[model samples]
Target chain A: MSDPYVKVRDLVTHYGTRQILNGVSVDVERGEIMVIMGGSGSGKSTLLRHMLGLERPTSGSIEILGREITTMSELDLYELSKKIGVAFQGGALFSSMTVGDNVMLPLQEHTKLPIDTMRIMMRMKLEVVDLAGFEGLMPSELSGGMVKRAAFARAVAMDPPLLFCDEPSAGLDPVVSRALDELILRLRDAMDMSIVVVTHELDSAFYIADRITVLDKGDILAIGTVEEVKNDSSERIQSLLNRKLREEEPDPDAYLARLTGTKL
Target chain B: MAADHETAGPARLVESLGRGTVRAVESFGYAASIFGETVKWILLGRRRGQAVRSGPIVSEMMDVGIEAIPIVTLLTFTIGVMLSIQGLDLLRPFGAEQQVGIGVALGVTREFAPLITGILVAGRSGSALAARIGFMTISEEVAALRVMGINPVRFLVAPALLAMLIMLPSLTVWADLVALIGGGLYISADLGMTMSAYVDQVLTTLEVDDVMHGIAKSAIFAVVITVIGVVEGSTVEGGAEGVGRATTSSVVKAISAIVLTDMFFVFAATR
Candidate 1:
């Protein structure tokens, strides 16, 4: 437990000429729920993308289970991916497949279990996500929150060592949001998996996070326990916690650069 | 101002030509890259591995080929009737109406059947491939597949390619048989000729090699149609509108490729 299960050192990422992550560094201890909190355009999603090895960083490194992901080959990365599960924000379930089939996909792909066993496992996972009888329905038939829960079911289907969830609480109602947050905490404890959740929902983040990392404009503003973050003295952290609207004066020449040929 | 305008006209023309050339080259390069990847997967890929499930392949085969039959039959039968009618009328002016049976047989088996099948199938299956793949891409299903360690080629494109290769030639055969029926109807009804006489003529005029020559072109057409569809579909940029655009362009590209490839086979096989 002393050693970090996932470690990032000086990660820099860029999209075209714009730097999306500016030397961000963080560590995720084993069996801990690390909630990445940031407002829109704060680069938390970019950081999550890096952690998942979905996008390559411009500089620095990520070590997942002591293996540097940036230098891993396709075959090696695939091997690494088997131990990691990701539940995308939009669910990203195959629209053509049934909810049951979607849940059974990773198992069917990775294991040679009998069809009956696979079906049983799928139903069990669905039961875990409170989608027990909804297996026959298509993704379109499910409500938005149900779809997210279904995604969560599929992500844990393989029992991966690490799990990543992107914006799980966004666009969900407060009741559904709280339910999902509780589900996340339950799953982490039950499965003993290290989880990383990226979201901007303050309530959900506070409820489930073992620790919180707040990001602002491509930089880490604060990193500590939930209580530490709530009581942190930094003005930026305080403003984020209070949800205060930014009040910066607009610059006119910058606006002209948008109208003119950017000659300013 | 007049002198500047005079120079700018030619300069604009040159710039436009340069841009057009670059765009054409880029498109060609993109097509070639996908073609190379497809060939690699077809030759070297494992059969239904962990990441590439067999269910989708079978489903795609039905989607891409099996469902395309009725339209193929109707269109080719119409073409055969038209060809027979025109052939007999044209030959009647020369007092060579007896040769109409021979002309229809050779034309349907050797060129028209395969050509018509290519066009129809390209429109049906090629557009479907593009639309399906483009929507999957926009929905991030493709990314999910990739993140799950699945190769898109094995999971999506290869099965379609394999299905097309098997189905296109089979469809061409069906087209040929249906076309002969159409021609037979025209021979007996309009020309007051015997069906036996037309069958005998066809049997002699159309050799095994002549039929094989056309069947070979259908295989080529299948490759072209499916490749264009997958390429255009997989590379879509925007949203729902992008899927629509990709589907349309894939159909157009498939048909154009079919026409050009058919011409090459026509000249080469005869020569």
Candidate 2:
């Protein structure tokens, strides 16, 4: 309802003994595209999963459109889920369903519209992703980029007010990733929706980010506009921008314990 | 210390067995919860489209029933012939070979057809259900369905439970009929008994209760097999090989549960 269409507060998450996110927080304004950039295990994807309500945090809250998702009932959650779409890193389309069926699924499941209208709606969504005629293709038949676009089509099929894209540019070539980044921007501008993109591509992040959230090993190193982030005086942000690795060496005992699958 | 070491092997064996029993019971409860949720979705839950349709139910029937007919028929037919030969030989010792008709009829209708069909379906369609759902799980299609506001239990498990319920009893009936026919033909050929005599004796021997009892057991077996498959599948982890392991686990679990259920039904029904 407010300017911050998405607000994450003090999100802490863990898997087994590993803490993935430690008090991470972020906010994305309505109609703005925020890019969350982090190295692997920095919790960008974990944050995305929490926002999508795919998993619960250890202690924190994610509010989408002013509703806390973690506490929603099953039916309530289903209703909320229908209003927010997600494009997974791996496309995550149903392999058994056709691209057309995959996109039409949301309409079919949620609407009383007839088959003809649902088909047209599906085609329109597919067209939005530049995958108009590829509707008949199965996910298995699509190339990596096509699969990504098809997944994007399915995610936006319901025309949700909010969308989350995880690693949309991760495995794509530069040209396709650029194209995807442009498409994401276009979706935000034309569809009047807020978006949060989790990616590691520096160029794409800087190119498309209204604000970039840099996460380093479960903590936010910086959060501001691309220029503001670049101008920030933190050495960690400087090292991240310069692609510098940590200079510290691993402890021998910890290394040995890790090698032996020992828990600390 | 020496005595403790000597007894450690047996002690460890008992401890492991006890743990295994607890794990099995826990898994059964897990499967039962999934089964309960699936039934709720099938009957009263909020999910709609695809799963509640007749299309999935029929497809599952063809998978669990129609496709299984030939093998079930073959297996039951072999057992029928074997039972006839053995029954005739044993009765011949007492000049009672004519009683083979009642013996084979009662055996096929009351227990053999249902038990064997249960085992076969558990091995065949049950494992297939687990593999399909497990692959969907590992590949995140199950999660995808969830994120899209569809319950995976509704989308995947409910149709399977419904289909198994519809088809298992029907398949058991077919098994009973095929076994009866096989034994009848064997008796006509091996003992010079007329087909009419064999048919008459079978019809006289098998009451409505006998047939209904077997069908009831088949329904229960269907429930057990379906639950185990769905629960094993929805919990699959690791990856591609996990799907395979889930399939095997479902089969083993379904068969074990099927036997345990059958034993319970046997005791309860007979009393």
Candidate closest to the true structure, highest DockQ: 2
Runs in model 1 lying further than 4 Å from the true structure: A251-264, B1-20, B47-53
lDDT (Cα, tens digit) per residue for candidate 1, span B40-77? 76666654343334666678778766788888888889
Candidate 1 lDDT (Cα, whole model)? 0.87
Q: TM-score of chain A, model 2? A: 0.92
DockQ per candidate: 0.48, 0.57
Instruction: List model 2 lDDT by residue over A49-111, tens digit each.
Output: 888888988898888888888777777777888888889888989887899999998998888
TM-scores for all predictions: 0.92, 0.92
Clashes of each: 0, 0
lDDT, residue B82, candidate 2: 89
C-alpha local distance difference test of each model: 0.87, 0.89
Chain B structural similarity (TM-score) per candidate: 0.93, 0.91
Deviating ranges (above 4 Å) for candidate 2: A1-3, A249-264, B1-22, B46-51
Clashing pairs in 2: none
